[model samples]
Target: MAIQIGFETLVEDLPGPRWQALFARLWPGYRAWFLRSGAVARPSYLESRRALRQHMPELVPTWQRLVELAGGGDVEARFLSLWCPPPYIVGCSQAVWIDPAGKEEPALLRNYDFAPALLEGSWLATRWQGQRVAAMGDCIWGALDGQNEAGVAASLSFGGSTVSGTGFGIPLVLRYVLEIAQSTAEAVALLQRVPVSMPYSITVLDRRADWATVFVGPDRPAEVTRRKAVTNFQHRIEWPEHARATHAAERLERLQKQVDGPGTLEDAIGALLQPPLYQSAYLRGYGTLYGVAYRPASGRMELLWPGVRWPQTLATFAEGRRDIVYTPGAEAPPDPDDAALAQLLTESRS
Candidate 1:
């Protein structure tokens, strides 16, 4: 199938008209996803709001504004809180690469692998929390990955597992990081405070070549490491089946090599644009929709594909759209060891 996705660049400094329009267009789908197991499956509105305030107190004002713009309904408020939301899985590969320039700038290179249909595809330049942020938006106000004016950039990959617990989703946590963190160490410290719903490996890079990959999950404390590259799994391969299905080990090895090399930023991106780093098994729930690079020293970012590069900086962000078609292969055949796969599936995600 040839999947067509329309990506938009909305340059807004606050929660206002443009944001409301986005919420109106995306709310219905988000509502359905939020209530997949029924409204009671999620926490109460008050509980959600309390969690937001307790963990991300700095974002309380912005969260309130977004809730108001989203129509101020109970479900809308809870959904925007991103507290204990539905379990979602995305396979991706990311790395921390330093430029070989005279000053050695740092770049966060990432490939967001997931279904094109499920991608919100919003590129936003905003100062919603008094700091300029250029980010790929998700959950209406959250970020898939983003950079702050202070030169801290971060990206995420789902840590391989079926385990989940009571906490906020990783997207909101990422949003909080860009809103307040000024460096990689600061970002890592902030990440440790927020409890996450799912396992995720967040790679953070700052302008001074300071970077670390922080591994976080609902059931465990966040772990900050000097590792330069991360794929879906973290620490060790927790989900062997998923690790195999997504070629997680292979992809991680490739990214680790790239991050460890003395390659330029362009060289890192070039490696990401090719296989087995570039994924296409959309039917199996992981396809490389777009590759992105964040240059903290230069205060710029760019998106990449096979033949396209969309570059922008906070000062020169343009409001526009890119409609790209993705042609991905079908799902791989099921494993012969159905009984083992079935047992893995029985693990509770709640």
Candidate 2:
């Protein structure tokens, strides 16, 4: 059976009941994931919130609104909104290129691999007032990766560093870049300046086909490169433990080979969907959720699985074109309170 992925628009003024119900549906699993790290103490909530406000002050309002809608004042929720501690997520490959010949618009292909449990019952498209993004995270306000109407496509991969320090989560950074930056250059500037909690890489492509991959973390200044392919590792693998998990060096070599070879976009994408690059969804946690190709110049996007393709565009998306929900067997069932919560949410919508 195909998993269901919902598509909808999001706005700042969310109804209390609807937001509460969504939180109730998604929070249990998210909370479990948060607690598994055991990194933050109960009293650290205020500290985390202060850091987020001091660094990325723009998100404070968004966070407060979400807290209010989730029935107000949950410190864990607030801390999570600030940063996600590691065993950093793994298994993603991102590549971008601009044809000097201008034969084709700049395109980016990405495969987001993570624990299937985190992806289950997630929405692919979420729009908030000035920005629209596709994401697969439990946070109603963040994005794993997404593209905006301004022709900027942003994607992330684990940066292959085990170190943690005072920094922000990459998902919120992705959301912030897409919402505020209009060009690849602007996005790169923001990525370089933003303090990320973990080692992470963000590949950004713009309408002009200009692209850049930025490596960021709390401990170092961002390393910006114009390389066409970026996997998990940076210039060199700093964390030996994560080297194999990210497959950093191998995937980068493979992607570069495809880029150097003569072929169409189809050939490049086909290469990305195979072994080493495209991970299978086995009983294991690190599995490929989906593949996406974004052409920023045209605002054309496609989501792909083995036999499924869903096409979407910013100008025409009322809701997403197709919807699928993916719930792996390992995921817990809906909360017992969902029945009543769903009813209350519906009442509020009317």
Candidate 3:
């Protein structure tokens, strides 16, 4: 049997009752996890808001409006930044510009690998018509990855760096870009201006088949490259700890091999469902929760998993949707070399 994950679509204007309901549903767990994490650099609500205003002033009013819309209780904007400090995300792979042959239009494929517990009560899909953006994210009002109506799509991966600083998280950055940027060029320009707290790589793709992958962080100058895919590291593995911990290189190779073989979109997706890309380690919360392919030209999205495929557009998704759960059907043996790293991550969290 296939696991069924429930995804709700939200299309109302900002600060509506639905937004409040979602906040109420997701805030408790989000708060609990934040408390459990004992994040030393977690900013206060005012501090976070100040940083937002100073760096991305375009979003401050919007965020304030959302807080007001969510009933302006005790919820503070800083809670949203809790995950910005580069949590121990071990595996993720993304492919942009996967096809120029027009076999299926250019697409962006990503596997959001992280601890499963972090996503509790928060796998909500949002289509904000007012903002003209469609994204998948949690209660923090940040985007995990999304495409805008302007035919620009962006997705992120941990940049495999231990470097951290007092800057904004990548999820909110993604939200800002998706909401404001219309093309790959625009998105690239916006990335240059933003300040990021942790190392991350964002793959940007526009409807015209134009793409760029940018590696950015608080520690180093941003570097952009025209590429078909990116996984974890960029240029060099600045974080030796992660080099020992992750299989990012192997996953990248898998994607490269598929792309070099002139593989179709389906073939790439198939590779994503296998080892490294599609993880099965639920005990460590590193399993692949979901996989998505975005077609920027048509503003269409295809959700794929074992034994199921659900297609939806921003407009149609609001009318109807399905909850797809990912149940690990088969267990892949753990890589012995990586076991210690996984254990260390689990212990660090504990």
Q: Poorest 10 consecutive residues of model 1 by lDDT?
A: 341-350
Report residue 245 deviation for candidate 2 (angstroms).
4.9
| Candidate 1 regions with alpha-carbon error over 4 angstroms | 100-104, 336-350
Highest lDDT: which candidate? 1
lDDT of each: 0.86, 0.67, 0.70
> Model 1 residue 324 lDDT?
84
Q: State the weakest 10-residue window (summed lDDT) of model 3.
A: 120-129
Instruction: Give lDDT tens digits, candidate 1, residues 271-303.
Output: 999988998876555789999999988888999
Give the worst 10-residue stretch by lDDT in candidate 2: 341-350
Per-residue lDDT tens digits for candidate 2, residues 25-129, read 777665654565454533266766776677667767667767776766565455456564433455688888555455877788888776554554344454544
Cα RMSD for predicted model 1: 2.6
**Which is superior by lDDT, 1 or 2?**
1
Over the stretch 93-193, how does candidate 3's per-residue lDDT look in tens digits? 88874564756788888887755555532333454435467777744687777887788888888888666786677778888888888789889998888
**Poorly placed runs, candidate 3 (over 4 Å):** 1-5, 36-41, 70-75, 81-90, 120-129, 238-246, 319-350
Point to the candidate with the largest TM-score: 1
Cα displacement (Å) at residue 130, model 2: 2.2
Work out the TM-score per prediction.
0.94, 0.81, 0.86
